[model samples]
Target: MSDEPMDAATPAGAEAAGLAPADRPIFFIHTPKTGGNTVISHFLAFLPVEQVFPPPPQLTLLDGDFATARERLPGLRFLHGHVRVTLTGLLPLERLRLVTFVRHPVRLVASHYLYFRHMPELPMHQAAKALGIADFLRRYPSYGTNPQTRYLTLALGLRRPGVHQEVSEQALAALEHFDFVGVTERMQDSLTALSEHYALPNFPPARLNEGKASRDEVEATEAVLRRDEFLMRLGADFLLRREAEERLEKWFATRRAAQARGALLQGLKGAAAMPWVAARAGDAALSFLEGWHPQGWVGEPRDGAQYWWTEDRARIVLASASGRGLRIGMHVVETLGFDPARIRVILGNRLLKTETAPAEPGAEVSFRIDAATFARHRRTAVIELAGPRSATFAELDPATADHRLRSFAVRRFTIEPLED
Candidate 1:
């Protein structure tokens, strides 16, 4: 018996796989000041203007009449907006393809500040013109802290805009859902990639709403947008990694698997699985694959002992599943400011344990993983340690030159098998 669709609505991303475009329409989440106008111009060349939502003149409207818009949604082939990510809730997500562009937080905030100051009709123009960029950021963190991050995470139902100064696990996981995420600094290359992914004509780029700011102004603005900066770095890294997956078939399969895993993790909340890579040759000890700053240090074994430190969250992947229960232990040696610290241990998204670290070294924190837990997560056990406090050496002692924010340090890590 043959197994082919007899007239069913096409599956999402079917267009990318060479099926009909009408079934899987594109929804561009136009993050403001990220060269979105230029992208819209590119889309116009192929997608008819009549089939686009809230066309050119109204491009920046964040809240349009979505109630009436749904009546027109079926006929629309493309949609772009300066809107919240929650729009996905009202639309047919199963048939929609999501895309967005992000800029370096420094340039994005600078341009956003300058644009607000120059546009007299804007609500914040007077305030922007009245104060320096630093004052403006402090005065309006809601608008300045991480607007792009807020836009991307609006669907999460966060309490307020820019509420998080540090990137959270939920935010990073949220971004993975997008079909495409472009970086504004690499505008042309990103557009070309987008064009190929969607099988659309690649048109020459256009520049719109462009602006410039002094290095001082940009640096002052960038300091406050740490979350967005971290988010952009992750996106850039993903772009570089995506470039390495050259085979179209393999790339699609890999992404689909990741999407499936993410969905399962979300539904199960305490379950996990990712193809684990061996971190070291022996000793049954392993390093982390996620939930840490790109800058981390593994000190050389001194007197046959080694340690790890992170400026932010730290996680470790343990040995492959042995179908037996296990015990995991980590000894804390240093705290952010030579002060006692409280930390939480998380497995998948569930809280496994919490402990208070002594100011002195050699405080061991441990957790028990059952055989069923090992079987559920498959090849490895990924455990994360999170603390509420962080401080830099320079902040603690004026004499020091090291300025990177420091969390806690682990002097030793051990895993012990438990009787089944």
Candidate 2:
């Protein structure tokens, strides 16, 4: 990240200089558990008091209404709040530089679970009581599948709408419009990049939220377990599952090889076979063998491979392919609460609209896309089911447009020229 100061003539600095007040307030689209608070606070510190709009309560209706806020706070140069990023289109593009951050889904969810456990004022306990862990996990996709649902709706003062669509879909949609994307895992680096982008004097160290539950806390919570199970299931149905499986297989193989080498050096000539023989001779052998056999075949097992449906399986194979003009097939399976017919595929600035019929509960729906679309508009592709049956206007997060329903599972891939 560069440290050179931006001149007052520059767009960002012009807003800061109070010359031509920003046409569109600098919108900070906050994602929970993604260090949004720290980023907002840092900006508050550097920005003129009157120019800084306080972070809105989750999902408040202020997306395109900055004019009212600017009228009251004439010095306002920034409007930082929790809202859907898709709403950026509502603002004057040149004046607004959208920013947001993301974290690893597993860590984000775990952090969220802990944060809710401690904050009595937050809706976690009430939501949990109303919907127990099992029920919550089962319906979470419809309720909180989108990243927006998990954080924005509650944070921005948006009315708590009933489960509309998968929370994962909402998150992917929100990410699409961000001009600057930060990773929470590298907060300091992200902050540095932000400071450089806006030409701030210095970047402040971000404060870590305290009283966050530790790993043990997550391990102890039934909700966490359920959430993890749900995420794992989702990953399996999406591309991430394949990546995880491959990595797990590699790690297991490395460990086994190391163990075997150690045993050989220790003079255990038939050490590898000894455990199998010992287990076979004992009453506990059957159970031990059962567990060991599965553990040994960490990757796609030969027996399971036969049943493996690549089109529906969430694997990285398609995403890993090197080339432009490549075509890949994806199985849709059940559209769940969404209507298959209205699902529009958004690849960056381009929209690829397609009509699909519902598949059997576990069946796959195949769709294809060319590499040109992938390369030209591949930042993030969102599946939106927009219609009256999808969600009522009030049911939407106030910060987002009323007509849009998002999908949690986003398809991320890169494009390269195909080899001859």
Candidate 3:
């Protein structure tokens, strides 16, 4: 809320806890659909060819023992790939710096759905096309529930059907040791943070694998109304994602501040003048704040690319791309965890518009914030959305195990500068 980065006093992991740093070979898990390919490619470009395990094109992981990979690619210090979370037993954890990235449960599933439907090489494409959203969600738990948890914990890799506390704890414990656990949404920031922390090269990464120009992902998803059904299974995943986000936010924020300080100090020595350094830092901070606009009421968007849960009092900040006034627009979707209720929308706590819609699956609810609100801020504005009540899975379906607070879903939220 306060634009200030997280407090540096609290420790994020073992490194912060003052444990001896284990400068072991790096082991990165390229979880599917989390933009790991871009990361992998960048690492391949920067890392010494012989130091890259199995090399590019054959990226993500190796086929055999660590010893075999070591023999094949001598001097290799980093092992990465589309790997499993249960590598604790397979590798020397004490001697390896582990890292991975995760996306929001909903986005991750959607990306997989879109990506899988296009690739004919994958045998499941036809079946996925036929399964649609609901059937695909029901038939494959991954589309619905704690899918990433399976890859995070080892027990699930045993082909088991249920979640285990011990296994979850073990997996979390393993994560505690990772030098970095990045979120896909904040990838640029995450990479910069990683580079600063590890002294690795930092550069812009290319966006990877958009997918075949076949059926539209959104159309296919909407064709079968599974938003509510899909979220029902995301209870565990949402919790997991929240935890990961809180931790990463602190990690990235802290590193970002540190980098700013380091840059300023370096600038004082002729990297640039003090005023130039200050301007650069201010510009960076402004860009970061602009990115948080149109977020879910409760917190920032999960991946900065999609959806925010509603809050009794939510604020949407806006900054015009051209420093001109904006014609703000917002479209809200019925979350359908419970019956919908009337919601009040406010612009900068000055102007107000309201709407009420039933809490049915795929419910369309929307309102606009008057462009006149922008008159107060020249080129920036903060819009607020408030709901009479929060929704929960238990309230929607008595059998649902989730009790966490939630609100409506948002299909689209945006603001465009008013043209002359």
TM-score of each: 0.48, 0.41, 0.54
lDDT (tens digit, per residue) of candidate 1 on 186-295? 77777777887888899787555556556666666556545553344334223322332333333454444445434433333334543333232232334554444443
- Cα lDDT tens digits, model 3, 1-420, are 466543221124334445455344666767787878777765765888777775766754544655565455336667777764455455544445667776787777776776667777887788677776677766776555566666655421343336323234433543554567777787877777667667788867855545454456655664454467666665555666666788777676545544444444444345554422101211120112111223443356455345555534444444432344433334455544453445555654454644445432244454443345444454344455566677565777779876655555555544443445
Off by over 4 Å in 2: 1-25, 55-67, 70-74, 84-94, 127-135, 139-144, 148-174, 219-229, 232-420
On the 0 to 100 scale, the lDDT of residue 311 in model 3 is 39
Against the reference, the lDDT scores of all candidates come to 0.61, 0.44, 0.55
lDDT of 3: 0.55
Weakest ten-residue segment in model 3 by summed lDDT:
277-286
lDDT of 2 at 253: 44
Worst 10 residues of 2 by lDDT: 284-293
Model 3 C-alpha RMSD to native: 15.4
TM-score comparison, 2 vs 3, better candidate:
3
Give each prediction's root-mean-square deviation over alpha carbons.
12.5, 19.5, 15.4
Each prediction's total of clashing residue pairs, residues at least 3 apart in sequence or on different chains, is 0, 24, 3
Ranking by TM-score: 3, 1, 2
On a 0 to 1 TM-score scale, where does candidate 2 land against the true structure? 0.41
Query: Which candidate order results from sorting by lDDT in descending order?
Result: 1, 3, 2
